[model samples]
Target chain A: MKAFAYVNATNEREVVAALKTDGIALPLAGGQDLLARMKDYIDSPDRIVNVKNALDTTVTSTPEGGLKIGAAVKIIDLYENQQVARMYPALNAAAIEIGTPQIRHQATVGGNINQRPRCWYYRNEEFVCYKKGGSRCFAVDGENQYHAIFGNDGPSHIVHPSSLAVPFAAYGARFRVLGPKGDREIAASDFFTMPTLASVLKENVLEDEEILTHVILPAPGNVRSGHYEVRYKASHDWPLAFTTVVLTMNGNRIGSARVVLGAVAPVPWRSKPAEAALAGKPLNEDTAMLAAEAAVSEAKPMSGNAYKVQMAKTAVKRAIMRAAGLKTV
Target chain B: MSDKEDRFGVSRRDFLKSAGVGGLATAVTSAGVTDVEAQAGPRVIGPGDVPVSLTVNGKRLELRIEPRVTLLDALRNRADLTGNKRVCDRGSCGACTMIVDGRTAYSCSTLAIDVQGKQIRTVEGLAGANTLHPVQQAFCDVDALMCGFCTPGFVVATVALLEKYPNATPEQARRELDGNICRCGTFVRIMEAAMKAKTVAGPPTRQARWGDMGVARG
Candidate 1:
């Protein structure tokens, strides 16, 4: 690996100041992804701003009865956090579903949510696709088995890799961001964007000078949430398709619902049709099947990823059923 | 330079003539090989070397290494502790598994500087002079190791699993060991060893085990 200058920023101001400079400063949180990329020569930043020492790693309860998860909170911490387990079990399950025990212990929650796309072509550093500012997307005609099926409008087909972000969006979590201007809050749903709308080279709306501070989850009440993932293999592999659902039930009938799909779209694919199908209806096997069908109505599968449609349907049905405390069919 | 070489050449022959008598005198004085053949020169520490202090096997070691050196490379190269093998330099393989601050981590993927003050336990640190660690004993009893190349990592990972979940069921053990891979296909034996270790270790303290395989309550 090429040698680079390592800078340990003392505070948010120092981090933003360093990021403002022109020399390509990469922020290092858990170093789970950044260091690997550096070793592979995929990213050779001249300087690395170490944020592990700058941010707090604690997970605390907010005054509003929600969780305030620091950006540096490790994935293992999230999996074992008592408040997170009680308030958002789906988030905990999603955290556990990421990588392995070692990666979980070292990877931070903020890093996981902001991780680059896991597209094979983008990660290889050899394929110069449209996401890398090239003329065309390699996955469009090449190996797209893991590409998006829902939110691909053109030039890029990479899917968002964060399992936690799906549940975050389902729960309507908000992000606390720090930048050169000042601190600002953005909803998690708006934080992740599509390639067609945002810059093709970037995955989210985060600027190079900004740092994600913490994630704020609302207070738990009548909300029932769960996440289900279907993957080829369970170990250190990205999910083929997954679903996260948050439902507010009026006794046995669903009052409001939010269904989000992961690894099947450019962003967490929020299915309004599925949400509409669940509203004002009892969460039964038949209703879940209808919701699942509605979730995949607009899915346009690539050449090798038609099987993911089935996987996504199954995941959505299971997630909704689990959230409703119903058994799988 | 020529004059210096001529002077050194004459002194070398004179010194060699007296070296045999001096060698015998020194050997008699020290009762060992006094004129042993020269081996290799010492390795030089480079400018990029940084001082790192780590606690390994309940012992503190201060080592000088490059900032980019990984924990696996430091343990295997500088410390001469080769138990943690580096199979896949990526985090996919658990060949470089080690317990860092009571959690299992891939040493190959972890930077040495990142774990400055953490307690690191490698496979070599598991056994004493007379007794083996419980996990190691179980692995041996169950014949869990084939080819033995991945045994050290598996043993270390098992130790971590047992530490976190003492009463892990067979299915929980399987899921917890998912991070570890055995190319020799000793997964069944490894799982057996893990279950046996859980039986010997008794119940977990307070943490609940995740995954559908185990129905154990916290």
Candidate 2:
């Protein structure tokens, strides 16, 4: 890593102000992803603003009978919170399955959601993919095995690398963003943008001076939610395919549902067809199979990622079954 | 199998035992009163050699380093605490795992300046001069290590896991040790050593003052 200056921010205002300073001051949360990028020379900032202690790290009950999680809360604490384990199982499940226990212990929620893309081509300094404002996206023709299979209209093919974003999007959470202008809230679903020729530089709309401070989750009233991931390494590896399902139940019938898939797209691909299939139908094996098929119906895989379509379908079906209290493989 | 390589490869355990005499002698005043007091104010380390004080193994060692130095690099290069190996400099492999502020963390990813006042316990901190820590002794008795490049990191991680879950279940053990990768495939024996080692507790961390745990700057 290159030698850079370090500034420690004392509070939220200081964090935003520090980031707004000149010379590309990047906020350091857990430093798990940022340090790796620095070592790889992907990002060589002049100064690092330590924001781990600057952001709120609490998880408390909101006035609306919902849960409000501070952006800096560690992943382990989020997974082990008794109320979170009881109320939001999908969030808890995603938190636990993120990385190894040591990583989950040190990595923060804000860092997880704000992490950069993990494309091998992008992570390597030589490729100079489109995300880096380069001439072309190497994944277009080069070894694109782990590239996106959905939302492939992109000039870039890097997948969003947050496991928490899947469940947070499924839960309809909103982010309380802190910026120099003040706080603004953005829905979790709309926070991630599809890659375009114009907006290929960043995955989220968070400006350089803005910080995602809090994630406010409205109470999932009478809802059944589940999350399942398919990793080639059954141990600690990034998901090859994952799915999260949140269904508002009306006495054994699905009133509304949100199904989101990860690692198969640039953003968390919400399968509207799967949600429509589970709209008024009862969740059983047949309906789950139908929803699974609908989830992968529109997957446009690249050359080496066609297998993710089937794995995503299995993950969708298993997530629905797990949400319904059924035995799943 | 080179004779020169075998003779000069000094483990952190032996290095610490040798350096303990000189380190404790210099720890008389704790990095000077004014320097320690400067930590409470605003900290902005710049493109110079910044003074950093670390409480490693209950001994305070002061070093002037750059802000970009990681804890692993500082300990190994500056302090000569080479017990913690640097196998996979990224956080993927846990060769540089160390206990910081009562939590097991990847020292390769943790910046040295960011962890100034926190208590750090590395693999070298586990044993004493005349005796071995139970975890180390168990590894030896069970023949859990081969080639020993990754032993110190695995030992530190095992110490953390056993402290968190004394009688760790098989699943919990697997999950906790997933961060460390062993190419030697000595996992069965390593897990056996972890299970056999007694529930060892880490040194008690200094509790923050009342109402002072809120925004820890640097």
Candidate 3:
């Protein structure tokens, strides 16, 4: 990695001031993703603001019976938090499936949501893909077995890499971002933006001077949620596709649903079609299959990643089954 | 500037020698840094070689290294502690696993300067001066290693697992050790060793140096 100055910022004001330097300055949270990217020379910044000490690292209950999770809260603590496990089990489930034990121990919630794409073309120094400020996307005609299927309409074919993002969107969370101008709350779904030619360099709406401070989850009332991920490896591998289904039930029937698919799109793919299919219908094996089919009906798979459509369908179906308290195996 | 020159306008070698190049030493009390500390502002380290103090295996070891150096590189290249191998270098492979504040972390992916005041337990610190740690002994007794490239990482991860869960179940062991990879396909033997080690594994020898820094549980 190229040499960079380090600031162990003691407060939020210090963090923002340190980032307001002449050159490229970035915040270092867990360093699980940023450090690796630095070593590969994918991102070379002049200064790094260590936010592990500066940011809040706690999970507190909100006045509305929701959760306000600090951006620096470790993934392990999020998984082990009893309140999260009881209230937002889908978030807990997604946290447990991330990377591995060591990664979960070190990776923070904000870092996980803000990690870069796992596209091999973008990561390798040789292939100058659109994400790397190049005009062409190598994954378009090149080896793209792990490329995105749903959100391939853009110049980049990389999938959003956060496992927690799907559940966060489903549970209606908002991200509190702090910047030089102060702080603002953005809905979790709006936090991640679809890749365009102009915005191909970044995946999120966060600016250079801004830091994601917290994820505020609204109270899950009369809802049953489930998260399921499909991976090529049972061990520490990125998901092929994943799904999180949050259903508001009226006795035995589904009143409404928030169905979100991950790793198949540039953003967390919220399937309004699947949500429509499940509305006013009892969540059973047949209805779950119907919703699953609707979830992948519009998937534009790449040349080599057509198999992910089926995996995404299965993920949606299994998530629905889990939410319905039915056997998925 | 010359290739040998530091950003601080001094020869790199001379700076190292003056800053106590050996991995263990005193905190940097440079005039510029002391002046910076006098201000009511956050202390910034360096793009140059700056003094960084790390508590490795309960012993405070200080080094004058660049802020970009990783924990794995610092321990292996500078501190002469090379038990933990760097295979994949990325966070994907668990070749450079270490326990930081009673939790397993990918040392290769963690910056050395970021982990200044934390308790860092590496693979080299696992065994006694003469005898092997129980986890290390179990790996040997069960023949869990073949090429032995990923052993140190596996041993460190296993020690962390047994420490966290003294009576680790089969599923727990599989989940905890899933981060590491062995090309020799000695997972069956490794599983046996982890299970056996659980019986003999004792309490954590030392208390965590810092008590949950910045973390407040709700």
Candidate 4:
């Protein structure tokens, strides 16, 4: 690992001021991902501004019935939080499905959502793919088994690694960001960025100086949400394909719906067509199948990842049925 | 108290003799001492002194180290707590499992500074003077360890699991133990040891009442 200066920022202003330096100054949250990246030499910042002590580690319900989760809230805390488990069970399930108990305990919600992609090419310092400012995306032809199947019309093919962000996006969550300019809120859907060769070094839309403070989810009313993940093993591995669904029910018919597929795209792959298929329609076997089919219609799977298409469809079908209070296989 | 006189009332010749080049070189070569005035230029420590305070095994130790110094290094090197072995520093192997604030964490991935104020319980802290913790005793009883290098981490992780989920099922045990890796493949025996420890520790206080109740009500 490369050597770096360390700064312990005690407040948000100190954190932002430290980030304004000329040299690379990485923010250390839970260090679950940042430490791994440093060890891999993927990131060698000249200074690491520790932010674990700067943020509040609380999760509370907003006056408008939404949830406000601090950036430093650990994933284990999210699983054990009564408010999160009661109001956002999908988020709780997603938290439990991350890495392992040890990693979950050390990893924070902000770090998990802001985590780097888990693509093998991106992680290994030896392979300088487009995500690393090289020529092409290595996963396009190389071992592309876990690469993206949707939203891959880009110079990179890595999938988003956050399991919790999918539910957050499905529920229309917003981010409270702090930077040199001050605080601002952004919808969760707008937080991520598609990989473009124009700027290969950037991961998300947040500027290098910006720090995510909290995530705010909209009020839960007439909305049923759930998440289903298909993984290789029960042990805290990343899901091969996962689905998060938020449905508004009108008597027995679906009034509105939002279906987001994780680990299948650069960002959370929102299936507007699938949502349209379920809108104003009773969620039966046929409608669920149609919605599942519609969800993956735009999927362009890379080599060795054709199975993801099927897995994604099954996940979407099960998630839709689950949202509608129907039985799923 | 006079500026012209030596503080200890030593002569100038004696002070010059004590500050000789030989003495300066000896100071530079000493284990933990450095000669500040003998160098031709200001000595630089490099970006290698990252000061971190770690509370490990019920002791608060302050160490100046590199930013890359993992919690495993801070524990085993600075604090001299070698119970948490550093097998795979890349976080794949679980030889460096330790309890931080009532939760099991991979010390290899965890930075020492990150766990400054938290309570860190290493495998060394699990046993008393002569008696062993239930998890440690069960490991010995079931012969769960082969090389014994990974035993400390396994025992610590087991204690953490049982503390959190006292009645963890076999499948839950497997999932919770996924972070720990034993090269000897003593997983079955380790599972047995964990289960045995669970029984010896008994169910948690909340679940004990349910355990006393029969199937049928009055």
iRMSD, all candidates? 24.6, 16.0, 11.8, 18.7
Worst 10 residues of 3 chain B by lDDT: B18-27
Interface RMSD of 1: 24.6
Please give the lDDT score at residue B159 for candidate 1.
90
lDDT of 3 at B174: 98
Residue-level lDDT tens digits of model 1 in A50-92:
6777776899889998989988899989999988998998898
Between 2 and 3, whose TM-score is larger?
3
lDDT of each: 0.78, 0.81, 0.84, 0.77
Superposed on the true interface residues, model 4 gives a C-alpha RMSD in angstroms of 18.7
Docking class of 3: incorrect
Q: Which residue pairs collide, candidate 2?
A: none
Best by lDDT: 3
lDDT of 1 at A217: 94
DockQ of all models, two decimals each? 0.08, 0.14, 0.20, 0.11
lDDT of each residue in A1-329, candidate 3, tens digit only: 77888888887667766665555567888888888777776666667888889888999999999999998999999999999999999999999999999999999998899888888987775565666555678888899998889978978989999999899999999999876567889999998889887677678877546678899999999999988999889998999999999999999999999999999998999999999999999989899999999999999999999999999999999999999889999
**Chain B TM, per prediction:** 0.69, 0.71, 0.73, 0.69
- Expressed as tens digits, the lDDT of each residue in A92-178 for candidate 2 is 999989888778878998889888888998788666566655557888888888889889987888778899999999999998887
Error of 1 at B21 (Å): 70
Candidate 2 residues B1-218, lDDT tens each? 22222543322222211111110000011111221112233356775789989999889989999989999999999999999989888888888999998788899989998898999999989998988888887788667899888888889989898888888987788888888888898899898888778533543223422365573442
